[model samples]
Target: MTSGGRIEITGLTKRFGSFVAVDDLTFTVEPGRITGFLGPNGAGKTTTLRMLLGLVSPTSGSATIDGTAYQDLADPLGTVGAALEATNFHPGRSGRDHLRVLATAAGIPIARVDEMLEMTGIPAFARRRAGTYSLGMRQRLALAAALLGDPGVLILDEPANGLDPEGIHWLRGFLRHLSTDQHKTILVSSHLLQEVEQTVDDVVIIANGVLVKQGAMADMRGGGGAVVRTPDPARLSEALAGRGLTATPGSDGELVVGTEDLRLVGEAAHEAGLPVWQLSRKAADLEELFLELTSGTNRNLGPGPTEGVA
Candidate 1:
């Protein structure tokens, strides 16, 4: 089997009239790893994916897979497998027949349809009509269709949407196997940061259609502020200030240090005769980081309570 290739997007912008859906987005997805394309709702993630797949043209810039645009690929399905929507299948077709139709269309062998059904763990339901399948089964069928051509790259949007915990766990391992064992390039998009945090090695975060941050998950999580607790909070605050570290009082009256260096804060407190009660480094979780990055963008407001009610 052929390994995955690099995906590069440079200055990619998309606009619908005066509304900018994607603005100057730039990133590179390397082979042999799963990269998460993440953002809040209305952040242009779907628009960007559509543009990449050549379903929607970008107003400016380029999105390329293996140094060529998706539209220009001689054998697009054989190079990139994508499942942007699980409901894109014909409801009347059986699960196996759905994949068979796609494989036949792609000039793939009919036998490969059963292979994909088994590969995606949906062979037992292969004879079931898609309309009768549950949402989770539909997702599996969509994935099977995407892998029908045995493509090197997999692009999935919210693939875990309807999966149970066990199914989600299975998917995580499955994606990891594709990237690590099969050497496939995988790009999966989801607004649920916690789900993607466990599956992706690197992340490209966007907000309001603009790139907010992009880097390894380890680096992003490690770059968070620490919390320090001392009996003499004021003295510790002063000590941190003396040592060129900023300390602010947390809501619970604990001193929140601005650095991840627990030892540095402890030493400064010891030297200042402030008894250290607790000094723990706080790593930022994906949810916290995501909320911080996209705080003011497209937040939903609940309707006001009924006027003069009760």
Candidate 2:
């Protein structure tokens, strides 16, 4: 595959006995950009990644790499590089040996192993046993293994699991380089919404085994909401109620104004003579937006999740 290979997941579904883990999921990840796979715990993010990698059999549907299943690809390692879990390496083997083993199995160049070690900043300690490494070191080793083939696409699940702030910053820049400079397709899964916001250009969110939203991050912020903080909570609540808006008390003395315009909310506070401590329009936070869509309660208040790719 070329550096601009694309990934397509079509109607993907997986079941274990009677329980359905993933259901009718469909989306595409384009090359030259990073796409974030986001969802809450038990939202089937791992299951979906496993299916895409052909590690697990899907009950129905399939995911493809450059129009073919991973097993059917001419050179799987050269086409798609993946790091699904942090502690997948053998404890007894040296970091360099671990990568060497995979490189041998994949028929990749042995020199690439050392290059990956150097690239991931683990070359100095490459001779040490992987079992002796710290969690952050293990994560770096895993990333090194993924880069061994210099593949056209990368599918990583929570790659920042054990990274420090500096490591996370390094990873963000590295992945961006993989996409922008190398023109590779990159799909990464994470529950860290803020991190994703900082790193990814596009996002695909799933919840309850369904697609919540998928689109460019810029379009997401266009759907706005307001955050209101008030001194007289009771009067503000009454004012909001009169205007057909709902208000739920949030942490501290702030209120999470659900489905209320900022100007109208300010107008209500002014008319009621309630002192407003804070009132401003908030650009939609993907994490908060995900909750509002899949949690069910937020839907009853107003027009819930944006129609298509919110």
Top candidate, metric lDDT: 1
> Tens digit of lDDT per residue, candidate 1, span 1-310?
7589899999998766656778898999999999999987677788888888999889999999999999999989888999988898788999988888888788999999988888889989999889999989899998988887778999998899999998899899999999999899999988879988888999999887888899998887886688888778998888899999999888897887889988889899889988877788778766887889877664223332222100
How do all models score by TM-score? 0.86, 0.77
**C-alpha RMSD of each candidate structure in angstroms:** 6.1, 7.5
Write one digit per residue (lDDT tens) for candidate 2, span 159-234: 8888899999999999998899999999988866776788998999887567888999887775555778888887
Candidate 1 residue pairs in backbone clash: none
Global CA lDDT of candidate 1, please? Answer: 0.86
Compute the lDDT of residue 155 as modeled in candidate 1.
Answer: 94
lDDT scores of the candidates, listed in order: 0.86, 0.82
